[model samples]
Target: MSHPIYLTKSDLKTARSCTTKLYYKKLGYPTVDRVDGYTRILADGNFIVSKIAHLLYPDGIYISANLKTEESLINAAQETIAYLQQDNVILFEPVLYHNHKLARADILVKQGDRTEIIEIRAKGFDSKAHEDLIRYRKLSYFRNKRTGKVGGEWRYIIEDVAYQVGILQEMLAQHLPDLQIEIAPYLLVPDRAKTTSIDNLASYFQIQRLSTHRNSFSKFNGIAVNFTGDVQEIEKDQFLTKVSIETEVAELIEPTLTSAQKYLDYLIEQSSEIFAPISKGCKSCEYRASDRDDRDGFRQCWGDLADVEPHVLDLYQMGRIGGHETPLVNEMILQGKASMFDVPLEVLDDDTYSYRQLIQIEYTQKNKEWVSEQLPTILKQIEYPIHFIDFETSRMVIPYRAGMQTYEQVAFQWSCHTIAEPEAPAIQTEWLDLENTFPNFQFAESLMEVLGDRGTILTWATHENSVLRDIYYQMQVYGYHNPQLQTWLANTAKLGTKGKSNLVDMNALTLKHYFHPLMKGRTSLKCVLPAIWKTNPYLHEIPDFQQYYREVDGEILSPYDVLPQLQIGDRIQVVNEGAGAMLAYQDLMFGENRNLGIDNQAMRSQWEELLYQYCRLDTMAMVIIWKHWQKLCAEVL
Candidate 1:
């Protein structure tokens, strides 16, 4: 059967972002926005919140539909219509359709002449913190208060509900023609400004998967919530709050619905693709070239300009250097320039442009590596017992413990590679907690013990400083009386404060001094490591690093790409990134599989081991980079 073209609520959202993306989405063109580790955890969290939303109305009837299929949409719409016939009824996921556009509201309530639509989102909002951003009654956070423009970060969520309201209004107008119903729109989301009275509220709910795949956290269709507490207690605590966005919906519904209708018409009648104007935003488009066996939509849009080597987009700080109202690349595109060589050297002389950008352009054009003369002096100043550390934390929507607000950061794991002296072997020490308990204080205490008061503490970016500063505040709020920990925090994590900071940012050093054509104007550890590893063949010959040196299809892979994978039933899961670690933590703590009649201890051990190896590799990556830099400095001296 041929697939039907229905402009779904999700489609409306895509069209609003970029109409071209909607075209790519409908045609099943390969895109890079496929479900990944971070998104999977978010999906799992949203699924749990959805089930909790249903607990408030025990009498509500749930209308299930395979939202992917057109036949199911029709069947579900018919079912919802049957439910709507009652004078007073509450429905969950009620399907509404009109003019070939469809939407499934999170919660629908009908009471005599009153009707309400509530959309549940896993996204967090702090009412008190964001009060200034919200306009009174008119919108929650859909506009910039000063500019009165649609510029808020969470505008998409509000726009999504607006589209739903518009479609539902049309459906009612066509189906229940004579019914005079007053519709109210609301948003149900986690309010970080409010605290939960109940302890371990999030742990009470477990995510059980119906699918056989072990890493099926993202498969929301197969999830069943296993709650172990009274539903009434959750209602009393008001774990998630309902916020009315009636005015916000009213402000956007008309225009959103009209544009959606136009998009539907274009999809039906247009023979050629509707191309969005080329801009700097296209740099991050997911429809760009990938390794998949499908046509590249970005290539189709840019033609030969997309294939330009050392492309203008690859220039470091391209937009900031020109001091133009628009991005430099955008201005260049308008002037018919595409290659990095097209950018003139005279532009770098501007005061707005940093010397770093000049070095990038110069060395890249010369095809030569550039190391600063200050490298030897910088290397000489280093103290003994150097410490390289990496941390893994999660900012979950639902607080795992009580007395905490939603979306609070919980640092669960840390790994440190310490070198006591020059040429000494790297000693690895790690910590992890998988129990259903608070881990922030313990995480800080254990980390402090391993990193004593006599080494140069190193990290890739400012993330470590930010995380430590947050934990310092958390320690104060929790009334921890450890003077030494506080002193360590003040001395090491004084990132934005007036105090001296012992922490050294290696990434900053790279940005200031290092330049390699292989880096391609990117400084992320993941990007830099592979570039260095590929260029320096002697790294693979080292005994300690031989395990990561694997050739596949005559191509060498990064150490991160070689992390071990674990097999559970028919699924293989790996923990190389922060998102993967977050998922593993959730599974180990609150997943149904952990509590099933199986080898729970064995599963926990396996997850902990994977976490250990991944964290260890993270620190090891820093060690290798430092070693390469030291060798270069020695040769220059």
Candidate 2:
């Protein structure tokens, strides 16, 4: 079906980012251009949370429809009207319209004369954060730091509600002119104070593929039957709360929505004419080149028109300025600057991502790797038998076992590359636990056994250290005492503000000691591995790393491509990374049904092996990066 041209809340929300996307979205991109796996999981999660939140209002009507086809849009609108015709109806997913705009209000509480609009989002919130965002952002919503989209999390949420309120307010004026009008807008979000009574609160509802439809609740379509078991009953008020109107929010909403509509109209008229330059926001763009349509949204904006390659957006943490409020490079791009080369020469001081960004941009323009003067001294300080450790973890909405809470850190896997001496071969060892058991303590214990009272344990980032600390806290809370684990954690791990950390953060090393031209501005393993792998032929010759290299049509690919394809029913599920692995783990543990023919044992075995390789790649990736650093350090010495 041809994609509908009507502007919805999503389009309204997204147009704040890039108006050009609205054009591609309205015109429709090919099915090949879309990858439904990762986002579909998130959509399902949102739906499940919404459903659970709906339990708070027992009398609330769902206004159900397929929502995947044109038929559903018509039906949903009709269903909403039918519900609205009655007095005092609490409706969920009510369809509202304003001119060419459409929105599915999450929940609407209507009295004889007063109506309240509440949007229930699965995204968590802190009240102070929300309040501060609203207070600060309404002032800057149009200023220099504004994310082209209505920026800030709470700002966007409130903007959405404000948008809905604007539409409903306009419609009600005509539809029920005599009713004494009172309109209130709210956002219902997961309470920060609420803790999941069950281990896997997010696991209960399994998500299906997103409906090919654009503005639809396809995730919840007939999903109620698929959910098994029940989460511990959360106190409705405790779990979810109406956003307090402690500040003046109503004024902010109307102005934002007006701007949203103005932009929407302009973009619609401009269509593909909207020249969206390659900006920092492009870093997370999902649009890809397609089969039927070769020039996808990203390529059209970046490749075809921008005439820029390996652009400024590629710079690490290039999105934000010194403060996270304003998007740095995008604002620059909007002002006609397109490349990192366009950034003026400047002093880059300290650890703020902005400083890192400026440093990267300068280096990229110079076309040289920037090695700090402290490299030799830093390298010398490192104790030998350096253990390079990397962890692969999954924290899903559902907890799998007892004593686990929703989205709790479960360290299911770890890989360590040990260099015992200067000339000795790098020995690789790893551990993975998908044994339908809680592996946090076991993971810590295994890591300790391998690490011993180590000489310099290295991790790419603070993530590993944070995971270990969480394990220590869990040990304390679970009342499972292991003095050995606790002592090792105290000695080796950086606990809070104290503890002498034997572990060195390799990411800090990268930030302080190294930069490669190919790294652009990224410090992530995703960018780092490819940058190092493509440049250093030493990796191609190493037996331990040989399996990872496979030249496909003259372009090398990571071993992630070689993992087993999962056949669930008629669909071949791609196990791409951690998100996919988490879904697979949840399916194997909780989604088992003998009649469905998803071989529980086979699937578990497949995921176990895949997780091992992915984790091993992570650790080995650290080793490869270290090797590169070592080479440069040796040369300097």
Candidate 3:
């Protein structure tokens, strides 16, 4: 069977990490359905900058298009060689091959006898780029077949050449075996400059002269080039200027396997070794779901590294243990000292209390002060005409409609509680209930009714506003005009300031404004809730709604049968019993739940009510937090 051709750096990285991931990639299964907005913007910026960098070498030939196929790549390389024979072509986006592996260079400068490779990176020069350049240089050297030849020279033209040289030198020392190479650094002509090279001129005094000389280029191997015109504007904006340099020695050889395939093989070979229970590589591993309970599997994979502190691994395990001990274990794990298995049972001398209880006691003692100080201030600023909103949405890979990039959030349900006045009773409002599969325009309209003419509409994050905007856009696209929805959106845009409806992110706020002892140095709502309020809504919440949805969708169980089996009372009991236990387990697994407090039954009851109340209080908390932040900003101004 023919092997799959995965040529990109991302593909190689994935293949090296997980064969299953590589297989999924080969099958055209998407690892990411859509890139984040910020990432998209960054990518676009990078492309634009890269194109501008190529304009530094205006006469450059574009040897290749961004091709996905191996055949296209080979054809491009042939074209690059052919173009090289004719003139001093500044080859843009050239695909070069070494040992059957392919790499695309942003700019390849063919000047007389010596070919200077110029690589353009969007980010400012950093150690990472230097390392990448070193690797690319090694690949180039090997592929270009210049290993045996001692006098061969290659030049690197980069954006920040001087800064990158140090990293390049270090890498070359480590990777290259006594190969004499000369590197000449070239700085880009600034936007205001007409002429380029400012070499050998005083940094302060040369500004005017450099600006004037920026457009003209010096003779290199008797060939003259111009550095002025915008490369992106040249040839209908098709080329980029980031080049990969290599020696001729590296070019002539052919490997039996492609870079992606070789990486995949490496992953499969090292699978057992890399999948260790240690948390070092666990944070981003694709195999995390499979290792949930596979202790032996963990031992086989990462047992040797068990002595090392497990961070995410400990957290994952603590989640499974369940209860008050969960936080305790989480704290211990976060401390980077002991794993749950290492904790001595004899340390918990209080026979009346379980080992879990001892851990909670320890955790509470550590983090209570921070939580106490911050919680009151966080709770004080909430005012009336408030809306408590929660959105249940799913992100799908692949843009479902035109003008939509990959991954759109489809809002399925929203639970809201509205209070008209601080003293008045709040009314519960909900939309798109899971109970009904049909479109609920009436539900949406009713929501709009309560949300009339606007007061502070509180949401946990900016997500609610996004969901509303998405729905509004969808409605407009489909020609379903509700004047009320449109008006609400327009008002929200004006007030929220760019679709960010007076929205507050509690997670971000907590990190910014508060800390908790029981929180065990973690800021997540799940962790914070138990620490501050002494209760967890998630604890013993049988068949969590999300999990239930997945199970139902998979046709593994009926919705009617699932909820009936998990009676609310039984679920509540599960929460009460499970809370302390998990917190205790967390203490053993991690170190201590820093936010836990002394077991005051009176305080516990109050805190329990507060925990449930706090879940309901989140939207209020967000509004309160936002108001406080605004006040703080005003005070600063």
Candidate 4:
């Protein structure tokens, strides 16, 4: 029952990141949460593919035995030696253990005493993969001597056979010279089509049933399954198709399964480092959940700590938190590098401060609470009833109209909860079910009627004003004449350009004014809503929000044939079916509306009430936050 003494992929990755992290991981440091579903799928897929590669060269020695431990690496190295001794072509997973360290080679191919190590990745060859393979080969070369084996050759194998060939070949040419191996042309293996008949036979065989708990489709009876055929047909159609290439490789080399098991046992004996946190290991380590305590402390002192740091500038790069950027502005204050005035109390207290504090100071101040409080004061100097309005619109890509960007916002449904009198509760009014044809114009007309001539119009985000302004401009381009449109334009233009005016973003507000313990980790409206109101907007039972969006977006039409019973005051207005199709389009452009309740009609009604309550609560949250900002402004300004 002794723990294995081998380095895992994660351990190697951690070693790359920082030796300290690796050291901590080896000492059994607590990590983070379990891998998400997508990552799990990838890990499983890689293991399956690796096994298939092993089947391709059957007589190959398995350097590592414990699929879960690092010692299997030695098994792989020993397998390579056996293959070389027999002058047999070998397919193997090689584990290189040297100086009490371990690493894995995805596939090792030995042809007549010449061996080449292959690293298999499910991803197509990319620059990152190129860099990783080079590093892996170097590690293998250094460790091969410790395991009493020669580092013969190296190759990087990836999934996209056609497209990645040139890329891989080029990288091999560039990096393999130092290792004294002339780079051969890279090989790409396209995904083999699983014939319908083979799939049926495989399913019928239910070979997986033998190891019910193990979902390995590659390994059967301690041998990799590379080829599939009826026992009678095997002699007639030996090479009909290389269905089980891995199994075929296994059969050719014909290493005893018992020997493979011994190598596996050795790997278990040698692998002793508790999954540690090396800098490189963080890139894709699954055992991070075990390092949660260290990560949390790092996150608190730094900003958002990540397991991996990207070498390139991309979305992935942004996930990394390291070096100078680790210590947040507030943390700088705690470290006595900045003064109190340099960081606001609200900034320090905000629940989303972890993320917001990452941005520069000035931009962070323009949030909901700040605008709401400042607006009332700014309007005190003028003589017009202040109007606070909120609007919901949908946009389309691929130009629903000519002369539009590939994606343009076409306002369809608007719910404006207006606050006219300063002391009065906001009155609610909304316009939905607009015909798709000329929705913008109709929306403009309705807007002008409610807005009147002289009031400071307010919205939650500057994007709202921009949406209106853009529609007005589009109307002019289309030669639609309206005097009110002109007025709306002049008024909005005086405020600012679209998305930069007297509008508010509640996201900004919460980041500035509030910091509930419940809101500690998230800033999205969905997260913020429940944190402030103790309820979720999407808690409904009818017309599942996903289906609603799907119907609206034209992914599919509403099932009118399966119409539910309509109760009193329930208005089921099926506007132009095509118009509603815009809903699905909107959903895709934004995101699936998870807030829609379930599919039952009675539950749908209850959900409708819940939606209303949620929306009302949103406005109420605005009000409460506004009051907090007013008090802070009075005290600070």
Candidate 5:
């Protein structure tokens, strides 16, 4: 059996992030967490963009056409060399191999003695805004920030391009000196500033997954790309330059190529399982997911390194405290002093919010939870008839309507739980639209209808505010004339114009006045809910919350953990997180959820019920959390 390709772009990025990841990744250890469908869709969307992007040149050769399997990468390299020998051929996914390392450039334009290297990325960057961010001191830069500047999240992307370029140049000098590698590394990203000439440009290319893999030339695994040009235009219009990668890498802002090569050389030298010291980056590590037999690679790696169950990496926002202006945690990591146990005593006592950080550390160490001293006083501000609203929405690559920009806001379903009084039955109302129609305006209208003029409209985070604000703009765009909507939206929604919002932010509320030991340091609703649910037994009896509580074999369960599975075509999909909900919406919208005549009405009914149950659980979760807070308040008051 041949060895799987270990050193790729992804591995290089991972190693750049933290050397430990390369070790774990190459070991074939499955991530404790599963990659969501939404992420998969996004990657494929980038793939589709690359395909259309190549059509812009219309001269690039696809070396990937026959290189389908692991074994085929070898053949692909040979094909790339053959194409390189030819006259000025544009190569899409141009294969470059150096020793065991391999790379496939998104687009390699080989023109006689000069070759241009282009990388197609889905990330968007406004050059003007980027410069502003740099000036505001909000962004830190390299030795030279003015010329060809790059900072913030683009650091990783720059490293990736640099690595690819370095590999190509080295390979060229050694293999094909005749091909003068005048490699001008450029990033072809979404030009948000440019408008597409064609209408519904996004919907033209439909991406469907095939159960079996297509040959190498296929766009992606299981995905069939059938593009229908101009969903709204009668004339054959193209968007080659109009929707091109508007933001190009500046000429002089390039980081040291030696820096990229150094990491690559180290990665090549390091064998499998290279253990690294803990760092702040471990907080968001994807490898945190456990594998077969409940073995967590993230925890195990950190545990062995620090010999502490909960380390400094778990400290809430450890890296953000000094802002981008300083690098305290980074300096510590460099000195091999980055760990929960190694956290400086002064570091925990310096900030205004240091009290909470100290409390978190204590509780984590003692294996207990901490509640704020002012929990009850803060909870007393609540009024009766609190409305808990939750929306499941999506921002698609393809616009649903003509003139709609890519990733236009679309709210598909919303659920609300009305608590008229302290003991009211916690009535539930919901609206879901999945038919072949835009649901944003209808969603807003239905939500407004359910929430009449009097009560504190509540939600877990600021996202709800942003959603309503987008809907307000959408209403104006669609020529929806309703003064009542304008009035209601202005008063309750976070208006971009007035910079005001009436909807109570529960996450902000939780952060200021509440902290459950179980919640660690994060304030997301899911984390907060689980942290409070099992602790309060009274909540387990409330009808709205009762269904979520059950002691099975002495183990407590979470409601979010037990949502039903959805049949999307032949595949069974579980709609659990926000990502899952988005994927589910896509499946339904694309007819993947519609079984062979599964009864139009019946299927719609099932979809409504499925969607409703998921959202109802969200609003109901708010109720349970509210009741739990009420109980905690009573204890303190």
Candidate 6:
């Protein structure tokens, strides 16, 4: 006996993106998108947003479901149906199912013949800029007013609501044929226009991830929400806004239902006839295997074309070749031009090919690196006591304190490596704040002390300048009284004629003058580091730099590949990337809810140590790149 194949809202979204993925997903193919919804919610600070939403709508009949088993879903759907029978009621996560198609609304309200279907999203909405997005009489709320094309994210959101509304309509028709209903769709999103009047509102809600087996339905069994402080305090502020997308949902409901039905049919019959054409977008497909694996759906689609090394997709900003509206890669793919070697010489000869792109193509074909004649001249401009600095910051969906706007920048950690003179050992200095207080002012103040009013400050991208600039303006907004810090920020952070910003972007330097065959089309610090680290053998001999080098199975690894791991009870984790640092910061702040056996203070210290190593390596990586460039310039001289 076969159980009915229930189609979910997530399933519809996946199908809409790529029909081929539907086949890959249903058959349990390997994928890189292993981060579960629960984890994503915690990382984005949406868990707090959801809790606040629940608080806003205080009265509701909650339909509980772990969504781990079919039985649980059935019970939840049954419970929701029973609640909908009431004359006037509010239901949370109310499930509606008919014809093996189902959806669970974030919140549902029923009054007489009217029912409101609310979908909660973590995306930010600007009322002033996006007023026309949800205008009543439009074909879609998702269309960009200027472009006349449907916006990608907005389209996805509208379609998600439409998918749920279609199911609800079907369910009501089947279950309660005599009851007339008026369906209204609304999107509940964080409003940037509104401010929270309560301090530490984000601190109230905490996240807890439960332990689960590796082969379980989800990475964790489920996420548990815990409130640390009083809920009445949060009730005082209105931070979220609900906008009616009723007309947009009405226009999309039928189309979404049709597409969902086709996807459902493919799932039911286990069909492979659905053809999603290979294009530039296929490069980012999560279903594509990282290593040699059979379940590489991308390879399964592209076949021999996917095996092409230095592929056409490897060309630097290939999409920008024919312009963004219509990418040249799409044209190449249509003409069966897959390999990078197969690119027409006439195309490269064309004036549209950027000098960076030409360098990439030329050196990539020659199997060598290209050093611009101007690089040495640019390298000679820096003075002694050169500072290579890096920042680790996060923008939270909800602000930690009052008088702070939503998605405000929080600069929590910094690392600086200073060299007093040529050939001198780089001095390491860093600052990290784990205390339960606003850290931006302290962060800027400490950074100013280390940097002082001398030497050139070098950062990977415009990120450091941007972070400091944000802090500069935030100082004025928050009325932070710090004369030295303000003056330093004005000189180092502010751009244009208003201030003399000395911060130089190394990434910009790389873009204009540097090209490594190993780096392919990217100029990111991580990409450029490995390219130079592998090619330049002299770096391996430095005593201070030797810590990053290691041999495993007779193979030398990149410094990033050999990053230190921190053991948190049973789990061994590494914080190497910016996103990982953000999560670590969040854990330090709100991890009291998690039962890790270690006390709060111990956990804080461990997290701080882990973050310090990662950030220290970042500045260290920059220093390595600088040394490599100096050596190259010296050799040329």
Steric collisions counted per model = 0, 12, 72, 66, 10, 0
As for TM-score, the candidate ahead, 5 or 6, is 6
Write model 6 residue lDDT over 1-637, tens digit each, in one string: 1344767787788887788887777666778856743356354466667667777788987765655456766676777777878889998778777776777788898998899998887777776456654464343445666665556678888888888899888877877888888999998877787777878766666677667432122212355667776667767676787888876788788988998888888777766656588888887778866565567888888888888888988887776666668777888888877877766555654455577787888899899877789999988888777999999987778777887778888999999999999889999999997765679999999999998988899999888988899999889988999988888898888654575569888999998888889899899998999898887778989887999987789777788888988776567878877778888787767654233455555665677888999899999999999998887778878
Please, what are the lDDT tens digits per residue for candidate 1 over residues 386-413? 9999988888777766678887888889
Instruction: Output the number of the TM-score-best candidate.
Output: 1
lDDT value for candidate 1? 0.79
In candidate 6, stretches whose alpha carbon ends up further than 4 angstroms from where it belongs are: 1-4, 36-44, 66-75, 128-143, 147-152, 213-221, 290-294, 323-328, 331-337, 349-353, 496-500, 592-600
Range of the 10 consecutive residues with the lowest summed lDDT in candidate 5: 238-247
Alpha-carbon RMSD of each model: 2.9, 5.4, 20.6, 16.9, 4.8, 3.3
Best model number under lDDT: 1
In order, the Cα lDDT scores of the candidates are: 0.79, 0.67, 0.41, 0.39, 0.66, 0.78
- Residues 546-603, candidate 2, lDDT per residue (tens digit)? 8778887987775566445666445666565656655555555444421234545565
In candidate 3, clashing pairs total: 72
Superposed model 3: Cα runs more than 4 Å off: 1-7, 11-34, 54-58, 65-71, 125-278, 286-374, 377-621, 624-637
Flag regions of model 1 displaced more than 4 Å.
Answer: 67-72, 130-142, 210-219, 271-273, 288-292, 321-325, 334-336, 349-354, 495-497, 596-600
Better of 3 and 4 by lDDT: 3
Cand. 2 TM to true fold: 0.80
Error of 6 at 80 (Å): 2.0
Instruction: Tell me which of candidates 2 and 4 scores higher on TM-score.
Output: 2
TM-score of each: 0.93, 0.80, 0.37, 0.37, 0.83, 0.91
Clashes of 2: 12
lDDT of model 5 at position 506: 87
TM-score of 6: 0.91
Worst 10 residues of 1 by lDDT: 212-221
For candidate 1, list the clashing residue pairs, or say none.
Answer: none
Please list all clashing residue pairs in model 6, or write none if there are none: none
Pitting candidate 3 against candidate 5, the one with the higher lDDT is: 5
